[model samples]
Target: MTSAASPHLTGGPETLVICGRVDADRAELTPRGELVHGCADILARALAGLPATVARVDLDMAGVHFMDTAGLQFLDVLADHGRRRSLTVTATNWNGQPRRILELAGLDTTDPLTGLAVTDPLAAAPPTAPASSAVALERAECLHVLQEEVEQLRQAIASRPVIDQARGILMATHGCTSDEAWHILRETSQLSNTKLRDVAAAVTASAEADGPPPSPELRTALHRAVARRRRGTGKAT
Candidate 1:
């Protein structure tokens, strides 16, 4: 049954159509001065309502322009849920900012357009059908294995947005390259006795509430840092 208000509806037998945004605002700019975080909430709520008989989910993200860690978390959750139901979830309109964010989070759209199976490079192998006598056991085992892998993939994918957001924040505040920002985050997390994930989460949350921007000072510092790094590399060579 489908409701007009809801962007997602469970169709008969084997399909689901989810259309909406997962973000709070549409015009918010990224550290790089681009709009982001659009239409994530709509997507999240839709994915949260997976039906048991669904074999495929078509996600329309064309209207989404900006997405944050929360949006990424929703995707991971949906991917995991679809896996448990043996459903394939294909995302459409993932180019531009949405595509960049997904790629940074390790959820490549070109992979398989499915669930956790896409995340697991090794899960493509065909499963052997069990003997009729032990069919129940086989089903249980398959479910269990798929669940474990899904959970792991979900966790990994969830972490990506946090990390990327943190990197973005660092780039804006510290005027560092993406790589340098990541390194700072890693080093700071190590020195502060915090998990890298925790640090990333803090940065993202802080940014949402209000934080620094990619100011001119930061850009200057970043340029200097890049130049220094280049010079060092040249010297070594």
Candidate 2:
């Protein structure tokens, strides 16, 4: 999906691929550029037709390397257009400065990296109408992306409870700040050679069994956190 685009201002490589069109109204863009004043016009024009559809528009930002205020304003314009047109615009695969800027600006970056809008238009066709193989292939790809996203979300949610439980256990035992507790948990996980989540679950489980200790709170948090690790290795805890 990556290829050299036209020469940039510096006569260097700049690439942007917008694929996954469900219809004339919706599509996805994968951008790779030093988005600055030099390319702001091009970027704006590229973004202009993005919201032509009345429903969803997804954008994958994993390709964008850099973006400046001009580029930021261009995205703002795109978002405003989405609003005016009642379009559901979303972006994902964010990292680094782009992610920070989007967060600061309070933009939506939760669009799945797929396109499912490929069906509604074709739905009204006669029941006997043959489906386009190209559309079928695209839809299958979209479903695959959606499935991967669902699995990722499930893993994240599953991990959150144990992590939070471990954090709380640390806070209560160490009398430490949340950040400090997190650091302690992370450090302990590293030192004990246990996966962080497994260590956290162990901590919570141990706390549940023995209850919180009075004066030996720190020892308990650390000991219980690593004991399961030792026990798993056939070592006496």
Best by TM-score: 2
How displaced is residue 63 in candidate 1, in Å? 1.4
Give a tens-digit lDDT track for model 2, residues 1-237: 222223331223463333344455556555665545545455455555444443666667786765544545546555654555556666678776555544444344443212222234454344553556655565456445544544555576799888898889877865555775666677666766666677677768768856543234444556564454445446553
Error of 1 at 167 (Å): 29
What TM-score does model 2 achieve against the real structure? 0.35
Give the whole-model CA lDDT for all candidates, comma-separated.
0.52, 0.55
Global Cα RMSD, each model:
14.4, 14.7
Off by over 4 Å in 2: 1-12, 15-20, 38-40, 49-54, 103-237
Q: Which lDDT tens digits does candidate 1 get at residues 140-210?
A: 56445544544555687789988998798877865557997776666656555666787677667667747
lDDT at 119, model 2: 30
What is the total number of backbone clashes in candidate 1?
A: 13
Q: Model 1: what TM-score?
A: 0.34
Cα-based lDDT at residue 170, candidate 2 = 72
